[model samples]
Target: MSEKDTETVVHRLSTIRERLDAGMDRREFVRTLASAGYAVGMAQLLGVDDFLETDDGDVPVVTALARDRTDDPFSLEKRTRTVPAEWYAAVEKAFEVNEILASSRVMGYLGSAVVPGDYRSGTASVTIGVTGDSGFIGDLIGTVSDSLGLEIERFEDEEFETFEEFRDGADRSIRQPRLARDAANGTAPGGVTCETDSTMATLGPAMYDPESGSSFFVTAEHAFDDEATVVGEALTLPTETEESFDLGTVRFDHPIADIVAVEPSGRLDPINRIDTSPPSTITGQYTRWGLADLLARGEPLEKVGAMTGHTTGEIQGIDAVTCFTDNFCRHGQIRWGSEMDLIDGDSGSVSYHPDPEDPEESVLVAGFNNARTWWPGQSYVWGVSAYRVNESLGYHF
Candidate 1:
């Protein structure tokens, strides 16, 4: 169907749902309609007769990412990964379950993500995070889980700890990205050297602010030792022989996203690749589908932190809402790598997966590598997914 036709179908269904919601709970109303076999009938009405003939259990794996137009600075090289239509359809349903749980925000809910099963299984599960009482939340989630054919694994009292202890836990031990670099390695693009106290963190890909329609550099916001003291401070890139060049000035800093946006200081323009041998070009951030596909494939992500240099590791969890770090919670977090894989200076680096089709120097950003789950029984890194940054701040990379 054309986009216009799809829009019309959506509008009609939405209007019907709005009317149905008058007598029933919004959630219940939709659940009832779906269970009453409206999905197939709705598809027929919308000229999607082909959908009715497909397996009821099937899900479509589709990515929200696309090639860049002139206004989209985050666009990079184009690529695609093929998956079985059945598997894709399964994943699509799992994402729906995840969204419902996320929207409910039931008491003590931490966060949730869609995890795909083995290739042949063609199945996917919704990983739900709940703290305190599992009995209550589980019962509530069980109804939806059963209705949707989703599996729920409860993470008991899973509290996410921010890097507060990691920072306040020790004294400032500054280390530059160049220290890990070879003589042949040129200035890293994503790696930034801040003037605040010569602090270091990995530079993420260049991003565009929709409001301003201008470009800027990005990095982990937690890199600033003291935000109040260092706001608007200049950040630069170190050179081998000549003096370091002015890179940009800090423009914005926020904790939820844990990213810092910088205004270029006129010395150089922002580039999308990292600073490693055969430099990896950051084409774009992964879509929700892409991350789920990686999780299902048991893939490993790599990053080039100013301190840690380059390292690879697997994803442990995704869509987690961490609470131990602050009074509130952080949602849509990706947990991967290990404590040993991340440290103080690696905060701003990105956890990325190499493009299978173009493994030479191209990749998609998995998320930001900001902190480690540094406690017992948990031994992986955690950071805001790249898409979450765009979701929260509307800055797309």
Candidate 2:
């Protein structure tokens, strides 16, 4: 080879090496390799496909709104308000704490929720529900404070007796649980009462499973079983005509989250709109940060029950873990204050806050209003928070 030819070849190779070192044309090079049937191996090398081989247990995601962020399940970018970055980070930590405490099954632990203080305070704390004594509260706070390197002040809401934390509460006039034979199914969206072959409960908003992409009728898991769940029990909706339509069968019974997923069997489809005079569409769900913002602002939550129609109440607590009826503790529960009427037939109704961006038209689900809790002086409603439902079960509104 001639010296001039060798010099030209060496210079060209050096330029190519520099370009690769600078990550120039990286994507194009990978795509070229992918087209040659080495996509899987190349993807692994790029660390883009490692999740496929990782054996991590079930991971739940907060689903994005259907309007624009359809591809983003986490919806990290779709936040409507400008929350301070520090506050968001702290609230997320609170959520982690709530999850840990619930999963740990600490002694005297009833439930807990992440409670965010004023943004100006730049702080957040978890409010825990303990049944027997106040001794556990100090130990929990001190342990967390020691690890976090900050003074985490904790308070106790001590009540002597145990009250069943029903998310939805209605008129107490009717004591005995009777089946409402009103129009069932083929009529409205969610928020109406649904009759399982035997008992009655409200139907929740439309939710789709990320695994199958199939829509299903949703409700509280306890709604189906008067004693225990049937093999193929289904729920029915009431119409104004007093007739009914079969929506579907109870496909999934999430005992931990206390949620039930029903596969639609009849012609009626589950709609995103809440059942009202003029229906209300569920645009999105409140993120962990979003819930904290509401708690900070002392915003009110609203819901429509078959018995109560529509009612509004303030957020008393968030990130609550409740051990009311279930053998296992229910984590990430929301507690609403004030007189929010929820009742027997309202077990599956959803509690929501109006979208501050669009109050008159759309709203975001706060949680499933399952039951109201009261013991003499203390009266507030508790239910599985919407964020918990998504984070734990991966079913988002």
Candidate 3:
């Protein structure tokens, strides 16, 4: 409390503040200052704890706390590269991580394609990103390299290190139509009519079980709004009434699926909905397909809402702010694109990835096609995975 004592305390407190900024631990630095005649309590009152205990969890958190200064310990060097083989290796790893391809799938990453990397002496360099303590990223890299027989190089601890995007995709393909779309497009020929407007532009597909021995089918939640008004062939019949029957309104809808089921109001016939078949090869020079199959880079995959039917596309990235939007959005959404072009009636349309097992033939209904992002040509979808969809719906994949 004496004048000399107060002056001594102020000087020591100032020295502790400077050391804390220089990466000195708080408790030790405070003790050192206190031993040197500074009042530790007064230093604490100067908001020292607030300055030291900054959180560095998420990318935004790290970016916000990381100041741009000559004194920063780590350096962020700029670079770029065109390593096709390396990029392919990264993609193969991502596919294995998502279980799309087996760990032993062939490496299709031959031939150099354009890519972005950090440049060093005209050699494109991609920094090996640091995974921090999780070690999950390290495992992912090893899995990819092992599967492709390649080694990743130049790893660095960058702000966002992982190469995996939200989803995956390849070239454009034919505007194939589902049975529902065939019906919508007036090509259902013998397919029974569901008087209900089943244009599910926003909903994802759910499995359907019909009466009268109809094969299993899938459709969207918004496809059948009202069962009472539907004029489809009914399952229950009377002697005086005709053969086909009308399926009733859907009983339940999976929270995450874009599909729903309806009890027929009249006689039932198979093929009410489209066939849920898988493809053979999803990429490179095909028939009944378009450039949609040539979409390996951009979006890993996407689903198209064509006038003929629901088709799949590779989703390169979401254009919206998806990671932390309100209840209206999900995480890691890249908001904006021109690729997800479906009509108003296509709400429950099924968006998904092509099945790798039968790439050109089989498909996985990932979700319902959603809105566009800030960038044109990108689209969004939402559906429960096989793990969750079956658990809640009392069904198995």
Candidate 4:
């Protein structure tokens, strides 16, 4: 080729390189290369280094937390693993799209959740629930989906129950546990009955506040009356065999998330273990992407409510936003199991899954099971996810 022709070719290649460096979509990059007279295979080869840094053919992500020492509640560490780059990109884009939809609060929007596609498909979709079917609403969602290259599944005319309705139907009939003080460990295991003056709820797994370097006994804030926090109502641990003892006072109350942290004032400190047939130790909690991975793998979450004992159910959705029950929307919620898996007194019980790293003895908390759908057409238990709690309150399990 002549020098001028060669210079022209170099200019085209340079422009393509600049666009690639500017983070162009991989598919768009390939299309641009095709337009520039390059084969799709060659385009992929050229962009391989820009897309993913593959180790054994996968990309790395920090999925969950793990404790350096089992006994040390504060010794938390992040766990990472390489995942398929395509799947990662899909999930990441789905999260972004879901956030946009949530922030916009589209007309007729009730709530929505992200469903990550399988590794082979390399896709993700947002499942949104709305109160009515409207053409404009559909068109708006369609336009957003088209522009972002994401799928959206819409559900219309779904009914939702309020917190008051759930509280009114509370069952106080379940037999309470007789917990023995663990003087040897100097900490209390969760999955037992804890009470405010007016109501009772299941004690959740211990939560660690990294900022304060403090561990707290967490439970559903709605279990107490609205004035409980204002009146300095004490939290009590009731035993079947012995007199009930004061566990602590409410340290922090989050009404919207329906969670509260109790400052331990008694001898027993909150530990990371749950009371089960073979006790399950909470090693850490899952991240949003980690929960999505579980959903894609068809994994079930297990919880030990004070009333229901031990029950397991499949995860329905992740990174969900729910606005039906309250005046404001609650984001980063997980919908799982079924309504039967949770009951009135089951509030504050934690939904968890066995740790992927050590499934036999340790587990990772998915979220707090504070409420379940009481309306028809939907049968899943819903609550604030562990990732949301960590992000909002700076607490981790």
Candidate 5:
């Protein structure tokens, strides 16, 4: 390109950057780039590579989608925060590298996750789980690490139970009801028992579908044997008073993510709260970068499962892709807590943290607790992240 054309491109990018700095969202920025005839490698053109060396300033990043009105489920507002430019850049690069590794689908690759270092380090790494050490895998990792100046950690893959095996051994018997009803809200909060045709799982927090303007009661999709059979099946919520009532019918079933959204069918509605000793209201969900920030700070995540009640543990990995427990890979997962934190009946429970903005009354959802590692070498609960669920299915807590 000529100097004049290069100047024109730079000028356009400057204007776009100004808009972004003024609070333009990611989707809008992408649309703007598309309209400007920018190709797939737009990041290069935008000078994102310079972020590594340019370390003086901070960059604005959207962290969460929070409720503007506590009572209104649809009043979602984007939450943004400014972070050290170097840390942001490193995390972005790590995410890109992680995607590359996942897409490669190298031999014996079981799963991988991106782990961002602290602000002081200004670095990130990808931790990979493989069947065993191989020359090809080592060479690929070395090549990528050398090229990008990124770290790659490898571990031997341990035996993990498939969904079928896990579900088969799970205790299907309904436990004594301990539902904590919020009489004022007239809603059923999560962290309580919900029944499917063959098994029972903990209900997830209330989720909002923006397109349909509807709220749903969510749980593990794998709670039922087949999606076809779940169509007309009713999801029943059992209360502490030994009363069982129909909550709704399955509105959406996503097998890959192992989540299901149930449309309400009765007077009681699903609320954005967990039925714990002191209930935690769902305020919003963290972004992928937000989760990385938590990891850098050594913050831990908490969950209230039907079987195990409440438990807490450290954040292990983010933006993970696991191909171990299923035939197809599950992408965009958050592995946190511990194997003991999650059990059979905890399949549909959610893992969350106290909302940074309002720690007392509200909490931010990290993801769903769908499965746990039962192997001897490793131990941690893994599940589909809330950000992934929103990105894939357009649902938010």
Candidate 6:
């Protein structure tokens, strides 16, 4: 049938249904339509002879089926190993990173749990979209494990269109790419060194705000020593604090992202602009990077953590879940590429993407550096997404 004829047929059927609903008698419906000559017109339009066929063989095959099941002759149940809290944290981190990286691949695209695998024997497996390099993936796995004090036993890598793609078998071959080192490594630029002293021996990285006149760093609940004096020597100290850690306003500590904020005593000039911006476009109108902004794969970014100094690298691949070791799983929130290696002390640092036109706006934080690549000669960075970070802490970017 022609397109126009098909439209007419659908429209006529719809009109008939309406008329019947309005109380048109079944016997009189076709008769009344014939009196109006609508039926003849429809028949002509549809090629009248096409409706005269009486071949049962042309009928579609519709079959009745029944559910089939069998009772188990012997009792049997599936078993799974319980992962520790730290291992679970790693798995979650792996999941988050893969999701975000995949989301960044497409415009206005947000990635969800792509590959969520079950825990077996001693490991959890996860897969994310393919970025530029695969070595970075290894780096992320190692980094997550070290942060949680766990190890990743087996690492399974896969490229997926969606989470279900990973679940289903596809005929595509997976490849591992080598990553390059960042341009900025082991070189310290001459700049103002801002520091804060804490009475606690184990203070995590502190965040600073030059614009809002606020500077804050987080430390563990037990960072405070007995005397409540800055545990380490003061360097560019903010000021004197009678207490070791801030207790009244806000305190955050956990196996993940562990640390409490130490409010700055004096006014702090928000340090704006990191030399990471690309040179183009208008200024001021540039967008800012925060926990809320989306991160792209293969994009080179920098991190200034408490442990690792100014380092840079490209973002690798991201996936929903990654096994730290056989027993430990780390979920990825945000995964990026980098060769500017990280260590244990680099927990809290700001990761900023360099945009030439939007230096101030580009200076955003990657919450804190969680882990590094497991094997040597490889480097990667993993952290909490800006969205998740803000949601949990109720902090504005």
TM-score of each: 0.73, 0.70, 0.34, 0.80, 0.82, 0.37
**Distance from true position, residue 46, model 5, in Å?**
14
- Candidate 5 achieves a global lDDT of 0.78
Worst 10 residues of 6 by lDDT: 279-288
Write candidate 6's Cα lDDT for 150-265 as tens digits: 22222223221342332233222332111111112311111112233332121233333324535444433223322333333232322122212211222234333333455533
By lDDT, the best candidate is 5
Candidate 3 lowest-lDDT run of ten: 58-67
TM-score of 4: 0.80
lDDT (Cα, tens digit) per residue for candidate 2, span 46-146: 22232234233322323223344534333323555565544544555566556555665545666666677766665667766554443644544443333
Better of 5 and 6 by lDDT: 5
Give candidates' CA RMSD values in order.
Answer: 8.2, 15.0, 20.7, 9.4, 7.9, 24.5
Per residue, candidate 3 scores C-alpha lDDT tens digits across 21-45 of 7887777866775676544433323
| lDDT for each residue of candidate 5 in 141-165, tens digit (9 for 90 to 100) | 4433443444344555435555677
Off by over 4 Å in 6: 1-215, 218-250, 266-297, 306-308, 319-332, 338-340, 355-362, 375-378
Ranking by TM-score: 5, 4, 1, 2, 6, 3
Model 1 segments more than 4 A misplaced? 1-60, 64-82, 104-107, 147-163, 170-176, 179-188, 192-198, 225-231
Candidate 1 lDDT over 1-397, as tens digits, reads 2345434434555555455546655456446558644542333222223333555443454443534653345444344566765566556566655544555545666556556775777776666555665454454434333433444445554343445655667444565454323213333367443334456666666776867877787777766765454458676666555466666788887767777788887656676777778777766678766787787788988887767678888877666566546556677788787877887677777888876556687777888887876544567888888778777888766
What global local distance difference test value does model 1 have? Answer: 0.63
lDDT of each: 0.63, 0.64, 0.31, 0.76, 0.78, 0.34
Question: Total backbone clashes of model 5?
Answer: 0
Ranking by lDDT: 5, 4, 2, 1, 6, 3
- Poorest 10 consecutive residues by lDDT, candidate 4: 41-50
- At residue 5, candidate 2 shows an lDDT of 44
Evaluate model 1: give its TM-score.
0.73
Task: For residues 194-248, write the lDDT of model 4, one tens digit per residue.
Answer: 8888877899878899999998988898888876353255788876556576778
